[model samples]
Target: MITTSRIRVWDPLVRIFHWSLVAGVAANLFLTEEGGTTHQWIGYGIAGFIGMRIVWGFIGPWSVRWKSFWPTPSRLKQALRPNYTAASSDNITHTTLGAVMMLTLLALLIGLAVTGYMMEETTRFWGVDWVEEIHEVMANALLLLVPLHVIGAIVESIKKHDNLIGSMVHGYRRVQIPPQHMTKHVDDRA
Candidate 1:
């Protein structure tokens, strides 16, 4: 039987923020009526979530902190190395491209929220066609990004032999422990 050690990589707050953002964006995109109260509230909630996440990135656990996954030049180089493989690494966190995607998504979401709010202020932004156009373009971009994110998660999960989707849902990930470390736990049990 195949087995691995599980670690609490994602804290509850991070997991909740992730799924809540997903639901909010999906609802706004596919379910809520445009320019309605429900849609506005959902957008506000998404904005709030993003705000909280930015704060948490500074104070959260090591695994969830910006330092851990931020796209630095060296880190990006490592991630892009020809021989680099998620399956070969014990630290299974965001890849370089994943980090870039996340940063881009955050910026886009912020832009969407700003444009959406501006579009509502008729006195200030009335007849502002460019604002509406930017909002629609960003929304479409998000729609495209969501699927690419899922596909990348699936690919990494398969390569690493871990349930990455479940990790987000349950806040845990199967981490590979070195054989030398395994003996200490076994001896303690005996």
Candidate 2:
């Protein structure tokens, strides 16, 4: 049996934003070829989700803040060190590569949504060649990036000997060292 500390690391809004964005991406990718009202709605949904994520990065929990995810050169080096492979269980948040993945996904999503909207506007002409080209480019690029993201998650999970997928679902993970060990370490600094 595994026990996890009840630290509310991921706010409910962040989880909702994550899964909703996943669904929106899937829907937009598979359904857009048919070109219907549903596709347009999904595009709008993706845009809304991305917009909320930008806002949440500013106002969300400290763990999910932009500063937390934005890797400085030094932090990136630290993250690349072998120590990350044996990360103490309490530090299960996104790593440097994970941060880059998030930013890439955000940019791709926004690009997809913008091009999709512009491609549909009559005044802008639904048949604008550049808009269609960029949409196709961004879509294919994102599809390639998705596999990389999955591989990174799998790699991190394997290195840390933890069920990363399960953690995302349950919003908790058990550490080998007790939470008290971490809390004590923090207290020593204060």
Task: Indicate which candidate wins on lDDT.
Answer: 1
The alpha-carbon deviation from the true structure for residue 95 of candidate 2, after best TM-score superposition, in angstroms, is 0.5
C-alpha lDDT values of all predictions:
0.83, 0.72
TM-score against native, each model:
0.88, 0.80
Which stretches of model 2 miss by more than 4 angstroms?
Answer: 1-6, 32-34, 80-91, 176-190
Please give, for residues 37-146, the per-residue lDDT of candidate 2 as tens digits: 78878888889988888888898877668886687797678777876643552454677778878788889889888887887756665888888898889889989998
Index of the highest-TM-score prediction: 1
**C-alpha RMSD by candidate, in order:** 3.8, 5.0
- Write out the backbone clash pairs for model 2: none
Cα lDDT, model 2, residue 140: 93
Give candidate 1's whole-model lDDT.
0.83
Candidate 1 runs further than 4 Å off:
1-3, 179-190
lDDT of 1 by residue, 153-178 (tens): 99988887888999898777776776
Error of 1 at 178 (Å): 3.8
